[model samples]
Target: MSKIDEYIAKRSKQSADFAREYKEESQKLQVAVEVRNLREELGMSQRKFAELVGKPQSTIARIESGKMNVSINVLNEIAVATNQKLTVRFEPVTA
Candidate 1:
């Protein structure tokens, strides 16, 4: 692995709290990216997407920025607004 990847692996292995927190943040980021990508793919601006979801532009910004602890309800709204399907899954954690 690269140096940064190696460091992250070491840190995650050495600290359960770190690993859990990192994984949580990573999941949030992935969701944020997916949301932003969906909006872009639909050729919708944040403000337009917010209107579709009945949220303010700032809320959409927060979700896209990964600064919000987004609710499943909000995610569902986004999925409906974007005409996309939402899926949730769990997998074994790897170090």
Candidate 2:
């Protein structure tokens, strides 16, 4: 592995709490990126997207900023608003 990859792997194995927190935060950031990308692709601002999703602008801001725990209901609302379906799956994490 590369140096950074090796270091992260070693740290993750040595610190269980750090590994869990890192995984959680990574997932949150990934979702936030996807949300922002979709909104941008649709040429919509956060305010317009929030209105379409029936959520407050602050809620969208929080979600997009990765500062909020997203719920399935909210995700579903966003999907419907964007004419997409929310699909979730589980897969093995590659090191």
Candidate 3:
């Protein structure tokens, strides 16, 4: 491969890794905040909410504690069960 091609490949891999990590962290933070807000607003215990959502109590605890990587679908289920709004947003990067 050309030197420029190699350089581009290296940088692309680094950028991809950074983007993946950032998204994972962002999603986790979002879920944590949403779960806490919904629980408090409803005055519901973790176990109670878990039962309502059909998720494990420990999973709910982990999610609220920022120790779980929650998927968008799972979070949507939580939002639906709790009657709370869980909104996600993204903006294009500016050059």
lDDT of 1 by residue, 1-95 (tens): 79988988999989999888988898889988988998899899999989988899999999899888888999999888777888888899765
lDDT of 3 by residue, 1-95 (tens): 88965765566577988656766776788779878888878888998989999999999999998889888889889978877666888889521
Give the CA lDDT, 0 to 100, for residue 12 in model 1.
90
- Cα TM-score of candidate 1: 0.90
Report lDDT (Cα) of residue 95, candidate 3.
Answer: 18
TM-score winner, 1 or 3 = 1
Q: Tell me each candidate's TM-score.
A: 0.90, 0.91, 0.66
RMSD of each: 1.2, 1.3, 7.8
Ranking by TM-score: 2, 1, 3
Across 1-95, the per-residue lDDT of candidate 2 in tens digits comes to 89978877888999998889888888888888888888899999999988888999998898889988788888888999899979998999998
Say which candidate scores most in TM-score.
2
Candidate 3's displacement at residue 45, Å, is 0.8
Cα deviation of 53, candidate 2, in Å: 0.5
Worst 10 residues of 3 by lDDT: 4-13
